[model samples]
Target: MGGNATVAVEATTNRPSSASIVQTLGGGSGIDTSALVQSLVDAQFESRNAALAKREETLTAQISAAATHKSNITGFSTALSTLSRSGNLATQPTSSNSGIVNVTRLSGAVLTDVNARVEVRQLAAAQTASTAPVTDKAAPVGQGTLTLTFGTASVADGAMSAFMPGAGASVDIIIDASNSSLQGIAAAINARNAGVTASILTDSAGSRLVIKGGSGEARAFTLEATETPGEEGLSALNIGIGASGTTIGSAAADAIVAIDGVAIKRDSNTIADLVPGVKLDLVSAQIGVPVNIGKTLPTNALLQAVSDFVDTYNEVFAALNKDLDPVTGSLKQDIAAKALKRQLQQLTLAPLASGAGGAPTTLSQIGVRTNRDGSITLDSTALSRALVNSPDAVEKMFAAPSGAATTGNGLAAALGAIAAEAANTTRGLGASEISYTKAKSDIATDKTDALAKADALRTRMTRQFASMDAKVAAYKSTQTFIENQVKAWNSQD
Candidate 1:
């Protein structure tokens, strides 16, 4: 190729093409322009960019660790709460004959270990009486004011005796020519809601108007009619004391139950007032057979609750004590985590208020021991003995002050407060999390800004290199022309 081989270059607005100029200048310019510019930019900013990247990664990891620690703390708090309930150690009522009678503990019921003879003589029934079968049940039984009075009534006498004044009220029902059927009468009676409900009893005997009063003796009502004079009166539908309508059902009867040989009569089968906290649900009439109702010892369940609490406590402790590493742990150097750890450890040793049973003063007295690894260990045998001997004391120690589900005053309460403080989103360790979150945001922003600066630097370097290459190419072109002219002159001489 000739010494000055002409090369056509593309047009440029900002600067000439650096690659084109570099090829034209070659070794004459004595500069590897691209490599030099990249080296300078890297020398100036790469370390700073790398440091920012590292810091961002660290902050992200810290945030993750903080979240995990917070979750563990919350779980521990919940476990503590479950451990401190009165129901955990409270006596549960069990009947020897559940098939005959189902027993349940009522709220706020403090059960004592006492045997009671419960004989359910009869189940309280609702007063239900049906009118004799009619040709069409839908036929109207006439509309009128069905005066309902509650008290003892007899189907034999055709009268409502022992009248209860306040319990008695009259309901006005409209039974027009459109509705004079037994079904219509039942609908009218049901629509009134006057201490009674009615329905059509359909059988081979045809449809009968069956009226059922509210349960118990007080719920018994006698239906007497005083219809609109022009309208058909409800006198023919009377089931009161065998006047004319056949009595298909009897009057409401009280439940008769004998407790400890004392006869108790209640309007409903569910007897709550008879026993202080005990409720007797009469399933069936077992007259002579006595079903014993009392509380059995609740030691095993309480022991299991304690064991679960210990397991949860250990989990929290282990996490807090874990070595601070990106892969394994996040809260090793965290102040809030360490503080919580100390507080929780101290709670196990702290003196707590004795519960109603008053067995042991401290948890250690119940055989929950602190291990050398900072985890808790439960001596099952000792715990069982303590529970068996003084369960109330153990319960009170772990129980909240009010002995209710809400939080206050106990080993569990103290631990719960500590956990809350550490995990609370507003003030405690939550502030630490917030700080880490802000740090992450700032680091991300800084990295973005740094990258933008790097990009700007690269653009500036590229523009400057292009300009330098163009200048060098122009010089090389002029030098080639001059040298060629001189060589031509020499050859001519």
Candidate 2:
């Protein structure tokens, strides 16, 4: 190992090997290279942020569209409800073919002491001379008289009474018990009240009396015999009349009420339809009908529509917020996502300021409110009240007015203008129109554009890595060449 004999010790340079160069440069082992890698990481985050921003924008547009659709449904529903409330909807008119007549007693009290008598007579002759005559002609001259006897005290004691055989309870006095017949009974009952319906029922048995009580309670019947002694004909007819002394009250019918100069006929007999959007229930029908008008909306349909609108709006907003919120850490990183979220919040809250002077400046006016975390809450009760109080105001706030320049910042109009250059369709855009076609076409086009941008950003990041890898390889090659030169120099020595 002496140095005199030309020791063959190989000299090697301290230059790094290829593997070391790659580890130091490509693997980001050094501070400078680590910083560059961090830059690429930051770029990746930016790409993600850009994607989320685009999604947020699209979702914002979608929420606007959904709000517009909801507004349209609400508008149509409100219009129909107005018609119903105003009683403008079709109804069957009152029938006029029949006549109604009221019947009331002139005496106002039941005739308890009246006498009723009926006689049966056959139109043909008797079968035999000895046999009793069933017909009036069979009875010999003046032998056809049939009479009912009422005692002398019958009328005074209120014991004598009479009634039409089939009549409900109406009866007339048979003044002459010896002479009054069934025909006289029928005539008296028929002439009592116009409300009663009277007719005769003639059959094989004989002619009988049939009477119907008028609209009022049944009339009382009593009979009193005329004291004519030795009247065999009156004694022969043993028709006994009794007293009926019961009374009942009659029910009064309903009357019609006119609404807004139009006869909106209802059996309830109420004046509720005079005021629009109110419902009244009939309370009683005595002298006149009384009613209680209900202030609440009759149906939950309108409230349900508002609820649906809120649900749909919240769904789209939630999706947007998930992508844009910084704390959630979605596919989109922070910068662009945060910007977009801030922009959306600003846009939504701008009109809510008191100075905005629009139809619905506050979220509560249109059924929305802010939660503790800046999220939105649906105020259904407030919304319902607002709609019930001023439905047209809400409708005009969301939709274009018929005759005037659109003063309100409606959802459809706002979204249409904002998404004009983007590939989203706004609500109320017709299918045949060029703007609408373009808007529809843009949905796919916008998505594609977003994807393309994301891909381009990814490609740029990869190219940058590739360039960094090439630089590391070149640095390793240089180190290898220098080491070889040092080896050659040492070998020559």
Best by TM-score: 1
* C-alpha lDDT values of all predictions: 0.69, 0.37
- Write model 2 residue lDDT over 297-375, tens digit each, in one string: 2225445544554555455445546554455434234232343334334434544212233345544566676565545
lDDT digits (tens) for residues 1-493 of candidate 1: 2433333111122233444543433343567776777788888898998898887777777787677777888777776666456466556677778765667766545565557778888889888877777777665567666666667654344333344534445556666666667766777778777778888778887887778887786776766777767676478676555446656366677888888899878888787776665677889988798888877766777777788878888877776677343356666566776677677777666767544555577677788898877788889999888877876566556554354332325666666677678877675678778988998899888878877887798778767776666667666666666687789889999
RMSD of 1: 4.9
lDDT of 2 at 398: 42
Which one wins on lDDT?
1
Model 2 segments beyond 4 Å from truth? 1-301, 327-361, 400-409, 415-493
Q: Name the weakest run of 10 consecutive residues (lDDT summed) in model 2.
A: 120-129
